[model samples]
Target: MTPEAFFFEFPDGRKAQVALGDRFLVAVAPYRQRTHPCQVHYFSSCTGELREETFSVRVLEEGKEVLKAQVRTGKDGFFELWLPRNRRYTLEVRQGDWVAQGALTTFAQSPTCLTELRLSRR
Candidate 1:
């Protein structure tokens, strides 16, 4: 049998998604990532070393922007984001003259934690 997915919603209209039996994952900010039980996507943005720096993140679908922010990575060289389930998004991260681009899919079976988004000089 498959474990069912669920959501947590707050009075302020913010929400999070999780699956039954899912282990806890932590989040950090500019988002402050305070929304617990999030469908956490943890990323390390790196350039030869773990870094704490400013990044512009743009999440898009079908050429239209959905979520966009300029956030700084935590001291551990990580940042977190949450997205709605079962959709594909284009993620673009920029820092100065470097850029990293990738695809993200929020499928129920997708990975919740991953390593670096390696940036390349542009």
Candidate 2:
């Protein structure tokens, strides 16, 4: 069996080299339109340690659902999502009894690098 793969593809026709267990932010925007690459790091805040886990994730834009999936954290304990630029979003992550929800935004001055969604026991 082959391991699952993930990466960023450039509009100029090039694939990013994102091996498993690596963390990076790659974005290719054209014509003033952009897709914000949000590097998500979900972990336990209990011990200030990174947790490798899977969680059911839901993203909403202006109260409207935009994305939902069961995202598995990589060996580096992180995942990535791309959303339209200049918008506000709400993310919900759930794993067993631990859950986290937070607001995220992509604006002109906003950093497109990372989003740290820390979880706590419910």
Candidate 3:
């Protein structure tokens, strides 16, 4: 008895040619785009209300800074940062004397990982 073979050609100029038995399974892992979302909210502790503030956002991987940006919260006191996936990262947000720190671990399956941070000061 002889086994059969199949060929698969991907659009990215990659080809997979393999031989298989009668009962066989073909598993293919395609390319995926992974992204991590980080949201920051700022508020006034004395007023207990949301405030639009400019913040310095930093993303660190393995104790080394990879991304740094000066972002300002929207009218709703919200700001978002998008990062790459499949990494454990340390996120830092700072504004004046108020600072917030958090960590996020992104997964390949769930590309859109959301991390929320709140910073408030009197």
Please give the range of 10 consecutive residues that has the lowest summed lDDT in model 1: 29-38
lDDT (10s digit) by residue, model 1, range 8-62: 6679999887664433232233222122232344233221234477889888988
Kindly report which residue stretches of model 1 are placed more than 4 angstroms away from their true locations once superposed.
1-48
Task: Give a tens-digit lDDT track for model 3, residues 4-111.
Answer: 334666799998867543332211111113222322212221111233667787879999998899876545444545555456777777777676676655443321
Top candidate on TM-score is 1
User: What's the number of clashes in each of the models?
Assistant: 1, 0, 0
- The TM-score measured for candidate 2 stands at 0.55
Ranking by lDDT: 1, 2, 3
Candidate 2 per-residue lDDT over residues 7-114, each given as its tens digit? 466789997744433222212111112223343322221111233566788889888899898876555445556666667788787878777787766554544334
Which candidate, 1 or 3, would have the higher TM-score against the true structure? 1
Per-residue error (Å), model 3, residue 67: 0.7
Question: Every model's Cα RMSD, please?
Answer: 9.9, 12.2, 16.7
lDDT of each: 0.57, 0.52, 0.48
Q: List the residue pairs that clash in candidate 1.
A: 29-32
Candidate 2 error regions (>4 Å): 1-51, 113-115
